[model samples]
Target: MAYKFEVYTDKAGEFRFRFRASNGEEMFGSQGYKQKASAMSAIESIKAHAPGATIEDQTK
Candidate 1:
């Protein structure tokens, strides 16, 4: 199974996505973008590098 992004609050309490490992027991990249679109873009970028990697982006 691929990883998925989960919601987590930042130091400023902003909503963002975080990557969990395939085992679902490890944390990877946690990205906080200005807009959901940016976050999605980030996910796309990541996907380009890792097609099967778990990726998630904000869509608000």
Candidate 2:
């Protein structure tokens, strides 16, 4: 797959997730969650919402 979501445990022993591109560069990362299921739920939420997401440029 060109894009993927990776779930991992950080050094602090907290569960987290990262979104990577095809070249293995991290596009973004999520805040640490105490539960792995919470991390997975975050991923699912992104999948469900990101497709219809809009870009709001607040830098104006």
Candidate 3:
């Protein structure tokens, strides 16, 4: 199966999304959003624009 991705309201009330490889390794990229729609959009965009890329590293 593809890496499992997830989105939810963070404690800061912002929308948070993340995904990890099968080995429990996160993808690489600094990504996040303040809105749910943006985060969702990012998920699609990332898949399209950065194929095979992972958010293994990001900044808060």
For 1-60, candidate 3 gives per-residue lDDT tens digits of 568677777767888777878876877532557778998897788778886766776675
Candidate closer to the true structure by lDDT (higher is better), 1 or 2: 2
Whole-model lDDT, model 3:
0.74
Off-target runs (Cα >4 Å) in candidate 2 are: none
lDDT of 2 by residue, 1-60 (tens): 599999999999999999999999999999999999999999999999999999999999
Question: Local distance difference test, per candidate?
Answer: 0.69, 0.96, 0.74
- The 10-residue segment of model 3 with minimum total lDDT is 24-33
By lDDT, the best candidate is: 2
lDDT ranking, best first: 2, 3, 1
In candidate 1, which residue pairs clash? none
Itemize residue pairs with steric clashes in candidate 2: none
Instruction: Flag regions of model 1 displaced more than 4 Å.
Output: 7-13, 51-60
Model 2 — TM-score against the truth? 0.94
Query: What's model 1's TM-score?
Result: 0.53
Best by TM-score: 2
TM-scores for every candidate against the unseen true structure: 0.53, 0.94, 0.63
In model 2, what lDDT does residue 31 have? 100
